[model samples]
Target: MTQHTDVVVVGGGQSGLAAGYHLRRQGLDFVILDAEAAQGGSWQHMWDSLHLFSPAEHSSLPGRLMPAQAGETYPDAGHVVDYLTDYEKRYDLPVQHGTRVDAVRRNGERLLVEADSGTWRARAVISATGTWTRPFFPAVPGRGLFTGRHLHTVNYRSPADFADQHVIVVGGGNSGAQIAADLALDGNVNVTWVAQRPPRFLPNDIDGRALFDVATSRRRALDAGHTDTGGVASLGDIVAVPPVRAARDAGHLHAKPMFAQLSADGVRWDDGSQSDAEAIVWCTGFRPALAHLSPLNLRRARGHILTDGTRALGEPRLHLLGYGDWTGPASATLIGVGRPARDAAHEIAGSL
Candidate 1:
């Protein structure tokens, strides 16, 4: 039997929840299918010490504000989990937990969302499946030759796992900086951070809230057909979160040039200098999780679907939400996903 709804939202993460909120406002009957048995989405897989760059007040989904933590300035992963669980119950959003969507295919006028549990026929489908499942590990030469433990950001849980080991942290993104700082602060590991280029940190005062505001401004300007390069990303790559800042000030968070290749014991620089290590952490980012949508044949050059707003250019019944700016400005963040979610829901409602 195929269940039917106005819209079928894939993934019950922040993006999916945001879309659900707006879809409810539009009075459209919809269902959110989540692979996880519980709430928290990608936050559930975050490192034990991971904290948002912004305060709880600044990071929230649509309709409800995230409650402030008692003693923490920034909310941690556990807090986010609690909030997401409560938010779902508060709104009574129809979420089918433990349902893993296998594929999404066109079925005449509706979309057939085939899942392990069952299938859903929806007039519109919103792909809010954020990139957590698809961790990108760059093809570094001689990576397979390394005899030590190599892990990506997704596999990292805590610094204690690599305690007393000399660890080489790769990539210059926020994950690399934070993980390196986490290990350094733990005082149990010898951390050597490396990036392709020098790491750039935003002002100490700048946080996720400030970044979202700048992104909003840049988005508005771009939408109005004006030239704008005023996004927070233009200012820097790293957000100088407290842990990262502390590690930097303590001389424990400096990044060297990325190694040329991995050696049997560790990594070798382009200058032929070698550094022995027991482990390597790749903090590289992720690609969008769109494998289920493969049946649609809607992908473009960069494994992304061309979209006019959140709606797919080739398939009007499909909307890509919370992937990145191409889907909508800052659509990947907790607070940033709301606008695109609203637009996606609104467009789907109007079309329906």
Candidate 2:
């Protein structure tokens, strides 16, 4: 049987939830399809020690406030999941979890969404499956030759997982630094961190502003092409502030240059140095999973979905969120998804 609706939202994360909320507010009929058994998406996969750099006030969804404990810097991944679950219940969003959309095709004036359960026809579709869907692993020589247990930072949960092992964390990103520090303090593991560039440390406080805020400001400047040549701070500076600084001073944090090659025993760096570790955790970034959408022909050469904030390839019904700078405050954060959702819903409503 083919079920029909006004809008069919794919992926029930923050973006999909926000879309459904706005669709309901506009008195439109819609159905939300998500692959996960529950909401929260990437938060469910985040490390146990992970917390949002953004404050509680900025982490809330469109209509509800994120409940936080007193003196909490930012909510943990579990808290984020709880808040998203609450948002879904509070708004009575029509979400069908565990239903993955296999393929989306335009059927005359509507869209045909084929899922495992059945087929759905809708006037519009919102592809809110954020960029983190695919993990980015570089193709380094002898990567497969390494005898160590290797995994990405996405799969890392806690230092307990790497206990009594020699762990080498690659990448100079926040995740790499934090994980290396955690493992070093575990007393059961030997930790080594390798990066391409020497990290430029930033103070926890910069003229009364929090380091996170300063980093965000700098990111905005870079995005807007207004970054100062010498004043710009790198990822290391952003992560080296406050808590991270203390971690470094306590001998829990150390950094070396990038890895040049891998061997049967361990890794060799660009400076001809070698480290023998039992486990290697790649803290590299993520990429978009668009190979399934090959029929669309909408991506850029760089693998990003080439769409303006409002439309894709002149198709107003196809909206994208969390791609580059389109998602407002929530662009990279879960909270930033709301604006894109609302905008996508309004655009769909107007088209209909």
Candidate 2 on 141-223: residue-level lDDT in tens?
A: 89999998888988888889877888888877777777777677667888888877765565554411243344356546756
* Best TM-score among the predictions, by candidate number: 1
Predictions: Cα RMSD each: 0.9, 3.4
Q: Lowest summed lDDT over 10 consecutive residues: which window, candidate 2?
A: 229-238
Q: In model 2, which regions exceed 4 Å deviation?
A: 201-237, 240-243, 326-330
**lDDT against the true structure, each candidate:** 0.93, 0.73
